[model samples]
Target: MKTMIVIPARLASSRLSEKLLLRAAGKSILQHTYEAAKRAAITDSIIVAADDPRIVAEVDSFGGEARLTSVDCQSGTDRLAEIALMHSDVDLFVNVQGDEPEISPATIDAVARLLATRPDADIATAAFPILDESKLHDPACVKVVMGANDRAILFSRASVPHVRDGITPAHLQASPPIFWQHIGLYAYRRDFLLWFATQPAGRLEQLEKLEQLRAIEAGKTIVVTAIESSPPGIDTLEDFREFVARIENQ
Candidate 1:
């Protein structure tokens, strides 16, 4: 199957303004993410689906491929759906959030593999167990509850599978894990992308502000693959600082 990775980026970041364009270690964050996605062997190509000319120019500066999508596009998934229309031959499109410069190539490949191997699933994503009680409680940390055989039952900002009886924290870290943190990385079939773009947001989706719910409400099967951990993506000044430290230290 032909597979391609698309990185959606724009310059209108509210927090850590222009976070994708922010330079760290002499390279823009978008460039770093592009390079990281290129490391994956499963993808036939990597393209930045940018929304602005400045973003397109930045990709050009780094000698990376980029295509400008309409500014009207609402989300990263919409950007990928735009590309899906252009590449009808491509069977799968992986949405690598441009902010995820430290994203793991193995995790990227794992999500694609999950979709390819599971005939019941139309989409696939990655998640890792959250052992920290604070993280479990943090609304910023999205969680996924798995059903039988790696199928995701639901995704939420709340700490799910609530230990109603209040068991020790150790129980949360059980091999299967009671609390699994959802990762933003995703892989979608070409047909699924088309369908997703046309569907309106579901009630739960609007409430949680999680776009993935639109699929769940549509009765689409989504498979989740377990990964070691999520990559630290920049969202605020502090996040950028930590990313800078990692680069300089490396």
Candidate 2:
């Protein structure tokens, strides 16, 4: 199956402005993400869908492929749809976050392969077991509840399966966790991407402010592949510094 990895980068980030262009290790964050995507054997091609000319120029300077998308594109998925219009040959499209410079190539390949193998599923995503109790309650950390056969049943900001009978937080943290943290990486069929762009904002999606819920509300099947811990994404200056320190130490 032909798969294309698209990294949607925007300059005006609320937390850390221009985080994607921030220098990390020896390369810009976007460049690092692009190079990592190139290492994935499952992807047929890699493209950076940028909203600003500055990002476009940066990608060009680094000798990486990039396409200028509309700044008005509502979300990354919308940007992916814009990129999809130019490439008709792509069968599967993987959405790789531009800020995640340390994203694993193996995780990218796994998500793409999951969608390629599961014809019934419109989308495929990755998740990792949540070992920390603090992360479970953090709304910023999205959670996923999986159904039979690794199919995603729901995605929410609140802790799922709220253990009934007044179970203490201590009990929740004990051995064998019950929840999974939703990883941002996703892969979707070309047709599904197009269809998703036309659908209006779903009720549950708007309430939770999670775009992935639009798919779940529409009764689409999203298969999940559990992966090891996902690397930290660049959301603030501190996050970028931490990434640099970790990479340099390694």
**Candidate models: Cα lDDT each:** 0.91, 0.90
For each candidate, give its TM-score against the true structure.
0.98, 0.95
Clashes of 1: 0
Q: Clash number for every model?
A: 0, 0
Q: What TM-score does model 2 achieve against the real structure?
A: 0.95
Ten residues in sequence with the least summed lDDT for candidate 2: 167-176
Which candidate comes out best when scored by TM-score?
1
Tell me the tens digit of each residue's lDDT in model 2 across 89-171: 99999999999888999999999999999999999999988877788789999999888888999999998867676546666
Q: After superposing candidate 1, which stretches have Cα over 4 Å from the reference? A: none
Q: Could you tell me the lDDT of residue 130 within candidate 2?
A: 80
Q: What tens-digit string does per-residue lDDT give for candidate 1 at 1-250?
A: 8999999998898887888989999999998899989999789999999999999999999899999998889999999999999999999999999999898888999999888888789999999988888887888999999999999899999879788878585786687788899989889999999999988999999999999999998899999999878878899999999999989999
